[model samples]
Target: MIEIKRLKFSYGETPILNIDELLIPYGEDCLFLGNSGSGKTTLLHILAGLIKPMEGEVILAEENITNLKTHEMDDFRGRNIGLIFQKHHLVHALSVIENLLLAQYLGGLPKDLNRIYQALDDVNVLHRKKAKVYELSQGEAQRVSIARAMLNKPKIILADEPTSSLDDENCERVIELLQYQAEKYDATMVITTHDQRIKKRFENSITLR
Candidate 1:
């Protein structure tokens, strides 16, 4: 489960995000909706432990992450939090499979080729596993990114502006894929987006102004 209370964040003197209390149960899906400056990404980053909030507590999987040390938090995030960025950060110089290997290596997990292969197959991008990242099409690259995120079998998945650049059809497909993957792994999925196309798809949503 994920819970936040008395949450607040800022950039120097400018306040960015504030929340009194929010709770999301395990295996649930939620959407954070807002316009460009609504702090949606800020909230997601805080949840991912990428950025610290000035005040309040963030509890994930029943642990108070706000109190964790830097290295502890990094280890926790690597093992429990899966992140999907707005841009696919795959290295163009590396093959698709190599990128996933790097993810596992950085996470301090042993190299498991079978896990990588299953993840690729699940995302329907196994055919491109040996190809360079640049060789995959936009949609294919996104799938690879998704596979990488799920490679660790994270308990929580955080996605930032995943469908902002897609057309209607592709937008739906991407969201569905994310939801399916989250459900398959029984992970709590949180997506932050300004796109209205997916707003209705999520029953539990929070709007930030």
Candidate 2:
């Protein structure tokens, strides 16, 4: 679950986000709709603890992340949050399974091969586990990214502009995959995008100015 209160973020003298209060309950899926420059991604970063707000609190699963120390926040984020960015961010040279192993190592979690395989299997990418990231098609790469994000069984999944570059079919497929993985793990899903193709997909949503 997530809660934010009096949240405000700015860059230099300009304000980016000024949310008063927001909440998303456990296992819920929410969409953040916004035009370009509307701060949808900024809000997502704040929720993920990747950026600090100028004032207010971002509480995730009962802990106020805004107050956590750098290392503490890093540990909490790695353990509790999964991030899927517009870019896959996979190491092109590494195989799909190797990329996942690296994620676990970077998160300071033990390398659980079985968990990696399960995640890949859930995303329907198990057969491509040994292929290099650069060798995958766009859809396959995206699925691999989802697999890596879910490998840790995070409590919240934050996806930023996930379907922005896809065609209609791939867009729907990605959304379905995201929902499936989130439900499978019982993780709250929050996606930020300006894509109208998915506007009606989520019942819980908010639009940013």
Candidate 3:
């Protein structure tokens, strides 16, 4: 769960995000709708503890971690949050399984081979476990990223326009995997997107004007 109040942020005196108040509870999937420059990414970064807000508090899992040191924030974010980006940020040289294993190791999570394999299996990429990251198609690589995000079994999942590039079928696959993992982990999911395809799946959506 996440709670924010009077959160304000700026880039060199120019305000980019000014969230009045927001609350997301467990077992919830939310769609955040915003146009270009509507501060969607800014807000998501704040939630992910990637930026320090000029004002307000970020409370996650009962920790009012408004002032955690950068290293602490990084560790917390790694273990607690899973992020899915539109472009799969995979290392081209590593094999599919290696990329996922690296993330788990970076987060200092337990390196359970079965868990890793199960994650890949969930994304329907278990067979590609030995394939190099660059060998995957866009859709396959996206699944690899999804696998990496869920590799640590994070309690919160944040995705940025995950379905924007794919066809409808692939889009469905993308969304379905996210929702399924959210349920599997009982994680709160907050997705930022301009795409309308995910609107129906979210019970509630926040629109930025």
Candidate 4:
């Protein structure tokens, strides 16, 4: 459940996004396709309430996030949105489980060890939960990222360029994992990317020129 209207955003004098209206229903998986400089990431940030649009209304989960205060936006995002960045921003010094715990703490949620372990297990990373992030392979680290994102059972999951740098096998695996987790938690999944390999996989897509 996401809706945007009269969305316009700019960086200084240059316009970045100019979406008139968009809607995504609950439990749907949508792909945002665009080339470099096409503002795919900018649109994702706006949807996640990480940036404010110059003029627009971003209604997520029946609330207009564009009007929320800073702290209120942060709290709402923490509780309702799960973000997966392309870089997989895990703390290298912390163990996999520790990184997950930090996310829970930052989200103002109680630390549920059983939930954390179940998340890891869902991503097939429970075996590496005690290992430091730096010790994981690229795939393992990405799995851990997925686990962390789903730890809170968010209502929406946003992934940015998730399959950009992976081999075909890993790319497929990542998409499957994202869809699996989304279905498991009944969350809407939105993935933004320029990767053509994934274009045919999603029936619902928005292309930015």
Candidate 5:
């Protein structure tokens, strides 16, 4: 489960986000809907421990991560949180398999080629395992990104505007893929987006303003 209590965030003196209390149950698929500048991405970053809230407590999977040191937060996030951004964020110079290997390395996970291959296969991109990220189509690259996020079988999946850049068909496909992987791992999935196309797809959503 994920919990946020008395959350408030600001940049310098400008406020960005605030929430009194929010709870997302374990294994639930949830959405945070908002417009641009609504602090949706800021909230995701806070949840992922990439940014610290000025005053708040964030608990993920029963662990209170807000008090963790920088390195500790990094380690926790690496192991328990899988993140997907609007951009694919893949290294163009590296092959798909190499990219996943790097993720495993950063996550402090042992090199597991079998797990990497299975993750790629889950996204239907196993055939492109040896291909450089730059050589793949937009959709293919996104699939590889999904595979990398699922490589660790994280307990929480956080996606920020993951489908904003895709066309209608690819957008639906990406959402399905994310949902499938989340269910496969029984992980809590949280997506933050302003895109209205996907609003109807999720049954539970919190709108931020």
Candidate 6:
């Protein structure tokens, strides 16, 4: 589970995020909807422990990570959270399997070839395991990203505008894959986006102004 209290973050003199209180229970999927500059991504970053809030408590599970040091935060995030981005940030020079292995390594997890293969297969990208990352199409690459996100068996999966550029079919595919896999792992799934097309897919939602 995750909880935020009186969260306030700013860039210079401008306040970018000011969440009062938010809680996400374990093993659930929640959509975060908002307009541009409404702090959706900022909130996701705080949840993932990527951005330290200027003042507030970001509690994951039962630990408050707001005061965790950079290195400690990195390790903690690697083990507890999976972050997926809209651009499908795969290493262009790495093979598909290598890309996944890299993610696991970064997360401080032991590599499991079988799990890797299974995740790739789930996304219908197993055949491309030996192919270079740059060789994949947008959808294919996004599938790989999903596979990598689940690689660490994280407690929470955080996605930022994942389906922003995807077509309807691919968008649905991505959403279903995240939801199903998160359920399988009992990981809370939180997706932050500006797209209204994704609103109807989930019942619980957090809307920011």
lDDT values of the candidates? 0.92, 0.92, 0.89, 0.92, 0.94, 0.90
RMSD in order of candidates: 0.9, 0.9, 1.1, 0.8, 0.8, 1.1
Spell out the clash pairs found in candidate 2: none
Residue lDDT tens for model 1, 26-96: 99999999998899999999999988899999999998999999999989988888899878888888999
Clashing pairs in 3: none
Question: For model 2, how does the per-residue alpha-carbon lDDT over 1-209 read when each residue is reduced to its tens digit?
Answer: 99999999998998999988889999999999999999999999999998899999999988999999989999998889999988788899889999999989878899899999999999898999999888999889988998999988999999999999889999999999999988988999999999988988899888999
Deviation of model 2 at 132, angstroms:
0.8
Cα error, candidate 5, residue 92 (Å): 1.6
Judged by lDDT, which candidate is best?
Answer: 5
92 in model 6: Cα distance from truth in Å? Answer: 0.8
Residue-wise lDDT of candidate 6 within 142-194, one digit each (tens)?
A: 99999998887889889999999999998898898999889989998899999
Models 1 onward score TM values of: 0.97, 0.97, 0.96, 0.98, 0.98, 0.96
lDDT of 4 by residue, 1-209 (tens): 88889999999999999989888888888999999999999999999999999998999989999999999999999888999988889998799999999989988899899999999999899999899988999999998999999999998899999999889999999999999988888888889999999988899998988
The better candidate by TM-score, 1 or 6, is: 1
lDDT of 5: 0.94
Q: What is the lDDT of candidate 4?
A: 0.92
lDDT tens digits, residues 103-207, model 3? 998888888889989999999999999999878999999998999999998888999889989899999889998999999999999899888887888888999
Error of 1 at 68 (Å): 1.5
Which portions of model 5 show Cα errors greater than 4 Å?
none
Clashes of each: 0, 0, 0, 0, 0, 0
